[model samples]
Target chain A: MTTITVATRPTEAPAGHRLRFMFADMITVTWRNLLALTRIPEALFFTTLQPIMFVLLFRYVFGGAIPIPGGIPYVDYMMPGIFVQAVMFGAVGTSVGLAEDLQKGLIERFRALPMARSAVLAGRTTADAVRNVFVVLIMTGVAFAVGFRINTTVVDYVLGAALLVAFAYSMSWGFAAIGLAAPNSETAQVMAFPILIPLTFASTAFVPIQALPGWLQVFARHQPVSVVINGARSLMVGGYYHSTSSLWYALLWIAALLIVLVPLGVWRYRKTS
Target chain B: MGANSSIAVDAHDLVKVFPRGHVRALDGVSLEVEAGTILGLLGPNGAGKTTAVRILSTIIGPDSGHATILGHDVVKEADTVRRIIGLAGQNAAVDDYLTGRENIRMVGRLSHMSWKSVGARADELLETFGLTDAGNRVLKTYSGGMRRRLDLAAALVAQPPILFLDEPTTGLDPQSRQDLWRVIEGLVAEGTTVLLTTQYLEEADRLARDIVVIDHGRVIAQGTPAQLKADLGTSVVSVTLADAGTAQRAAVLLAPLSAQPPLVEGATVDLTVDDGPKVAVEVLRSLDSAALSLAGLALREPSLDDVFLTLTGHKAEVANDGGTPA
Candidate 1:
């Protein structure tokens, strides 16, 4: 038999080219995740439906009962919070996706490849950010149908949506770490809900911080969710509720989360066995 | 390129102990695979076969010792090793949400193939693997064998010279297993070096040029299939008695017939001998004169099964406390 030559040479490129390859690898992984999301219609259906249900529950069920501090319309007061809540909930997909990949040995396959080590986590979070945008747009439409209006300029409204997505993207990194830590998708879901529940409900996402008991009010006002919700409220409504400080605090919270969770998620990804 | 390197895979005294369960998965295990040949890592469940593969593939590092693929360190030079090696683990790692073609292409892209070649290579692999018709269908709709085929195709997308197959056909049906064996043989003919771990003796005998028999994370025997069988003897004289007690007595009676002692397993006694027909006559006459009632008797060539039973004192499928299953 004729002997064939082995391809054992290292395929290392220049440092600049490697960086570009890393970005391309991340995009490829992101595209793969989005393609998977499209195939699972039920998952996307439930993700979109949950936010719409939250909008209706707060708009009609509790809108009349909870009076705003400044006599603002409850729909306007709650819509910004609803947008934040929707993206936060949508970010859970990042955890579930990563856990599933880990459980199914897809992560092992990716690890064996010559791709960038950070590509898997970065790609997953970016894909969830894209999904958050879609879910946020759908929630906005539902909010509009249910008597929610943007009192600010169209540019400010766009900025508000962008802020919500940024927050969602940062949360995706946090959830990505959880997903890597959990053994399976079910465990990831169970672990994520406990953290998400108090952060979204105990904050100003649905109810006014002043209406909460005094003991809970301090936490309800200062949490990241509340800060981002209030910032989105200022950007979208811009009345007595508007404050430049709220927007700055929201940006700072997003920056802090990214700074802490990005490396944490990548570290978790590498450490996952 | 190290294309002419004699030893495609060189591992030395590799040791690994998992923190969970404190399982010593690999205990001073070491083996080498020559270029352009297949080496079968033969073992039962939890014999550190998967652990060895994981370490060689650079998925995890050994607690001690070291391995190199074509002179590139598996741990320190992992990125370089990754460029030349492909791993298809026990589980089919292809995504259920993507099509067969799409899965191959995605792996190609991750392996750093140019976009132009990734698409063409994916299509070429799908066709070669007989998945061209089902290439467009999502993997959720594929059968177990199809998924296994696609998983292997994905691994080969970058044309890696060295391949690690960790029980690639463990759960496949008989026909699918044969099909995979044929594909593997074809690949080996083209000079792709393979390190295949298997619990199936027949699979190792059929595919590997050399086999390393491991038990409890240690190599007990290593040789070609023919040589291993020859070491047991030329032929085996098997006799089925009425009960376990009678079989034990018959083993003592027939122990002098062969150089090695008879192996008694419940109601059957097996004795390896140099001559088949001559040994068969002697065995029957001795048992008859001893008044031992024989249910059946047969003489056949010594298979790897006999070699394994002689060396390990147990069947290949019997699990021992070596480590967790892969």
Candidate 2:
């Protein structure tokens, strides 16, 4: 039998406490996610190692199979493209994690606590964005080791990094959306593949859209990946030819994603059914 | 309304309708827990117990109800309500990849405590739960009991005065469960007012000073365990299947225990009698004399099962775990 032992001390009566997510909450959530990632080395392998290997493989093996319109080595052409695709595909991991948490009812626990509703998603996205930075850096280093030199000035390099930063930020929203919406980890993975695989193959990552059939060329040119990659290539060429079209399209994609994702994430945040 | 402004938990017309308004998860439910009192909301699964817990805990907004914890409305002042209450849901809420100590520290940090305080509190809770030895172990490595205990400790990281625990000991082994029960009793002793929702009649019978029974979104009865059992009559004798023969043999052999015919469940037999334990012995002896193979037997007084069957028509069972009916 459970006995209710009454402690003699007067209870610490509650004041009119308004809930606030302290700075510590954000730090803790992010740190916890990082620690969790550390424990599961496999997540590290897929998010970091696989992308690094792909950048090398696609640059060497697949690069020779295709040619760039600018007459550069296909490695140079595809490296930027790989960067964008990896960020997009890596989102699947975030969604899968979200799905697992949902299945286990951890998200509901968070809602019940005093933490800010946005903090959970924000902390996760921020942690993941930090992770993406490492993935990009590793991939960049591998490209450099493979003799893919950038003829761009320091200013152009900074601009490219800035663009990558914004791209990663926007891409994280898309991934966060998938994570919050997909019902389970397996479903999330399945959903992510359709978005990532098609986005990769359809973009002008490996070759100039000119080589693609006239019908497929339209899609290749219009894809946000193609625009971002081209923008990056132009940036790499010492800012010689700047096309606002690619950057604008990338922004448009981000805006579109936020329009759909913010509400979805919020709905997922509050839903108990 | 109670004159005491310090009445910790106050809910009025706390109604919640789910599944597109088809089911009433909480129908005009109302409750008030004086500060520092451990009030147990007792009911079976699908009794709208968890639904009520979620609403009052601020996890879900009620459709047409008002709830307050420490003077904060659950809907209008949800953020404030959240600050005053800690909720441990039915499942283990710990992140399996993190160590138990890390999980506690993480929750403490989320409560906005200083790093030193959070760290100190983490160690304190770990010690309190007798988990100091296993604190560094990853949650997945811990047993079901350990995970559940960790969940309770996590909810306390914020140090909220009003705590809500929904079936906190559902799958724990007896010893681990006792350890958690001890922790909860200690919390209430230290002035924490808990709102516990549980199906374990023994739990409510022991820990709850006041028991509120809900079924189909409505509060059917509310009182102390003695009062409830006194009202419901006596406990029921239930026998589970030894192998896979179903509850037919038990039903046939224990027929005298029931006013009506013994219920032949898939793998168990259920019967209500004036003295369950005494009758169970007679039933077993009679069965053995008849050479009938016996499975497992349990002697329980008119439990929440009897209370449930008296109030509704059926007993609460595992098959109805997540099925919140209208």
Candidate 3:
């Protein structure tokens, strides 16, 4: 027969040790989510395939009709927006993942553990961000195949991609709150669609802000999604759409979202029944 | 009461109400579990058993009242309490996408075990749970019993002294349930204190050193299995008549033989008495004199099932759904 030992009395971890454990717990949880993602090939396939389909649909079907100002190629102008849109859509996975965990009782298990409470949400958002990175890389290859070119240096391109992923990560915290609040995965997806559709479509992800009506154009130009898309466009393409202010505005929005949503998500997680 | 250092889990007047339906899941419930023993929280479905376990395990804070694990407050010192307790909730609480080995290792890592210990412990747990062959396979491929075993194995990754099993064997087959019972008994033999919630009367009878019966979010009775059964009587003489009408007559005929009235369910009449063989002979003689033919007769000691029925006014196996919303 196998022998088991009784646990020793529990002692509180010191402050520095607690901090280190938090990071270690976050990494472990992150690895768990990513490992689950890899096992579900259909989920990965659909997430990446949806973006490629969007790229093909926009480049071949909508490219000729939509003209870019300053004679910039439509493919080049649209690719950056497509990259931002892909990651933004990918952020919804955070909501679905968290809701699924809650529904399947994994959240209860995690909450009962000695690990840091923030690790669950942090690990989830981080894993979704990593997935966004993979999706963006694949989109980059597809954009190149469709005659899209980066007019800027490799560093600028990388910066733009980083901005998109960071924005996606911040959005994930907001979706994390939604996921925890939702009762189940189906409802989480349903709740996310209304918020996501308006943000992506009303912004400059698919069309220019100038193409919209006057009243809508104001919102289109100033919205966080539009600001980030313009920031990415400025970094990668650098033409009429380029503005140094867009970068600052995008960073400001990301910071604001992270500040508000991180605590909000963690609070919702703590308050989850 | 002064601090009872030997109590592994102690709660005082716990109450919880789910805000959605305003269901009072737990109402002024209090219980304690002594270290190195199993306290079976026995109840029917939706009787707040899961809610009680949730509060004690630090999964959710009670609306009112407080609890402590190993003398540390569950709410104020949840992190400390978490370090010393493992909970296998009503659901498996395991990742369906991960392998059995990975699930154990993940929990070990989260429990803050060293990487080397995590690996060795994962192997040991898988072997102990009889999951060694399936350790490399993802959980999606496991059967219901394997998943439950893995869930329990994952819970023991840190070898927490206190364990809360909330209906751990609710839906398992007879074989699987017995296997789980043996495992739980082995753990307790090794000095692991367990707070087990179950609707299975036999489970409580076989595994629990003490029993607490809760219904409608309230504790109706509490004692050891024998004590609870003895509260009803020393023996249970069950007689199965040919029909419900005969059973009702048999109940009335046998009612005066014991302090408690006979429990009649359709064609079966069960009476609690101070003596088994003596009362059983009296019951058969009385039934025969009344000209009622007996289909079957059994004389045995009082069981938790009879205790639950006497206390709750319903059979223990009956599902009282939507009562507590647990």
lDDT of 1 by residue, A157-269 (tens): 98999999999999999999999999899999899999899999999987888889999998988899999999998999898888999999999999999999999998888
Candidate 1: deviation at residue A83, Å? 1.6
| Model 1 complex DockQ against the native | 0.50
- For A56-132, candidate 3 gives per-residue lDDT tens digits of 89888987887667678888888887888789878999999999999999989998999999999999999999999
Best by DockQ: 3
lDDT of 3 at B270: 90
lDDT: worst 10-residue window of model 2 chain A: A1-10
Candidate 3 Cα errors over 4 Å, as ranges = A11-15, B1-3, B318-326
Candidate 2, residues B166-241: lDDT per residue as tens digits? 9888766677667778788878877889999887766776788888878777888888877877776577777776
Candidate 3 local lDDT, B198-248, one digit each (tens): 988988899999999999999999999989988899889989999999898
Off by over 4 Å in 2: A1-24, A237-264, A267-273, B1-6, B234-305, B318-326
Displacement of the residue A74 alpha carbon in candidate 3, Å? 0.8
Q: Which candidate achieves the best lDDT against the true structure?
A: 3
Docking class of 2: acceptable
TM-scores for every candidate against the unseen true structure: 0.95, 0.82, 0.96
Error of 1 at A238 (Å): 1.4
The alpha-carbon RMSD over the true interface for every model, in angstroms, is: 3.9, 4.9, 1.7
Better of 1 and 3 by lDDT: 3
In CAPRI terms, model 3 is classed as medium
Q: Residue A140: error of model 2 in Å?
A: 1.9
- Sort the candidates on DockQ, descending order: 3, 1, 2
Q: What lDDT score goes with residue A113 in model 3?
A: 92
By TM-score, how accurate is candidate 3? 0.96
